[model samples]
Target: MQQNNEIPQFDLAEQIMAEQRKNASVRRKGPAKRVGAPNQKRKVEPLGHTIKPQPALPEQEQIIAEIVARDIKKLCKGNARSPRTSGF
Candidate 1:
């Protein structure tokens, strides 16, 4: 006896898919709807006019010490020294 390798279900599926592709090609699609205002231009503000003036930063050493002290305090939890005495 010889075994048949052909699949009948796969052949049917292929035929159905071909028909769907033909139908889709014949269908008409409308133009896409506009999302936002296309004609309006964005208002530009002068540089630094909208931003509030920031205070001058402390020395680099002071900044580094403050960050280190904060991290140490976090790690030590309740054992860390008070902020006033720590001089952070």
Candidate 2:
């Protein structure tokens, strides 16, 4: 345990997540970087509605959403650009 200064059974990637491990100090990821055409507008998806294309929740956005939601009440207040209520 870190209480003993043990190298945690998990590491930087293994702690946050092996799946989330990054090679660079900054990481750029997700569908926009993978599929979407740069500078294009974000496509819309309706609940239970699937368009002819697209994967569910790009990994990067999902991570970013989680980070934003952690302090959502603080980060999103008065930011009308967001589509959903912060805790909605």
Question: Who wins the lDDT comparison?
Answer: 1
TM-score of 1: 0.27
Residue 51 CA error for candidate 2 (Å)? 28
Q: Write one digit per residue (lDDT tens) for candidate 2, span 1-88.
A: 3467566463665556645555442476765666655797788866896568565678978998887887776566555667565545
Reference-based lDDT, residue 84, model 1? 46
Q: In model 1, how many backbone clashes occur?
A: 0
Return the lDDT, model 2, position 41: 78
Worst 10 residues of 1 by lDDT: 79-88
Assess candidate 2 and give its TM-score to the true structure: 0.19
Work out the TM-score per prediction. 0.27, 0.19
Cα shift from native, residue 84, model 2 (Å): 27
> What stretches of model 1 exceed 4 Å from their correct place?
1-11, 28-49, 57-88
Each candidate's lDDT (Cα)?
0.73, 0.65
The residue pairs that clash in candidate 1, if any, are none
Q: Residue-wise lDDT of candidate 1 within 15-49, one digit each (tens)?
A: 99999998997774545643555877889966865
